[model samples]
Target: MNLYRELAKEQPYFVLSDMQASMGMDAEAKRYMSENIRSEWFLGMILFNTRLLHRAIAKGVVFAAALTRSPDDPPRTKIQFVATREKALELLEQWRAQADGGRG
Candidate 1:
């Protein structure tokens, strides 16, 4: 199953699908992050029920088509998409460093 991980001090975060728009817990999911999680420079990619991808994007979060039903991206979108846990962390680190200023 997928999971949500908001790295401490990391500018980006990965929030698994079930955690965002599963049938019975959608509100709970958003609340968990909107309220519980706090950060100024956080880039968050929230996973939603495969079906919720379209709608979720309408809500604010950007969805790279490559991340829809699978954990891996094909090729073209891969450059714009960050799917794996490690890559997400790396992206976040880049964001964090940039936000801190001086060097990224």
Candidate 2:
């Protein structure tokens, strides 16, 4: 969470997380992180090579592709999950394009 707070200082950044070698987190940690996440901190995040349970959890959070917010609404971070680095990069490019007013 500290790392995320630090990263939040750079508001418009994106994250590409490789979770293949991760040991996984407990329910308490997951709840803590999710509840504490500041949606306005980052543009989007991609989690690649995640386990099945992680993928399910991610899907339950919010899908980047389905995000739709009015200018008057509060910010919501976009999150996506993929199986490969290539797919992750591809999705990140799409998010960048959207962020840049479709110019990316």
Candidate 3:
């Protein structure tokens, strides 16, 4: 299993993954999120294709940003899961939205 410490720079939520890459697959996304994320504020995984492009979302640090390449598969340099980086930031934003009372 892969270990991703934090999800964002100011958020508390984090993501984890067992697969090296998501490639837009839902199952891989789930696996990655299930393996790494271990926080209460953490949300579900954001499965994507490439890590090199999405690395910025994590803020540069592999452990800090996102887990590039899976621990299960070293040859591959892809990421599978994604979530919030900060808990306070997420809660505050969510709270604000709720207060605003937007609808789907």
Candidate 4:
């Protein structure tokens, strides 16, 4: 998180791959993820459901295509669930380009 705060020029995109186990975090870690790690940029989670409505209904906020709702701390972290790492990185590129004034 320190590195992201210091170096990330664009929005922070967290890649949750086979780390589903990691999601079962303890209170402290879960609190940190839910509160401290606010991603206005995007959060690409590698899960099955990519539909906005489903995510909204199940997780609170919705994620459709490359767009997502910016939810504040409390309910959950704002995350966009992708299918794979490639897709996640693609979303990161999209965010980077957007941050870079749509250059390249």
- TM-score of every candidate relative to the true structure: 0.33, 0.65, 0.22, 0.43
True lDDT of residue 49, candidate 1: 31
Q: Single out the weakest 10-residue window by summed lDDT for candidate 4.
A: 57-66
State how far residue 43 of model 3 sits from its true place (Å): 8.6
lDDT tens per residue, model 1, 1-104: 11223343443443333332345657666555444332222244433333544355324333333234244633221112334545656665665575569474
lDDT of each: 0.40, 0.74, 0.41, 0.48
Candidate that scores best on lDDT: 2
Which candidate gets the maximum TM-score versus the true structure? 2
The order by descending lDDT is 2, 4, 3, 1
Q: Which ten residues in a row have the lowest lDDT in candidate 3?
A: 73-82
Error of 4 at 35 (Å): 3.0
User: Where does candidate 1 clash, by residue pair?
Assistant: 11-43, 17-47
Using TM-score, rank the candidates from best to worst: 2, 4, 1, 3
lDDT tens digits by residue: candidate 3, 1-104: 23244334344332343224544567676556545543333333333333654545332333432355446733312233334335434544554465458651
Model 4 regions more than 4 Å off: 7-21, 40-79
Give lDDT for model 3.
Answer: 0.41
Candidate 2 residue 26 C-alpha distance from true site, Å: 7.5
Which residue ranges in model 3 land beyond 4 Å of their true spot? Answer: 1-4, 8-23, 41-94, 97-104
Model 4 Cα lDDT, one tens digit per residue, 11-89: 5454444344444557686545444443443343434324554344324323232144334432323355676567767
Superposed by TM-score, candidate 3 places the C-alpha of residue 96 at a distance from the truth, in angstroms, of 3.7
The residue-level lDDT of candidate 1 at 60 comes to 33
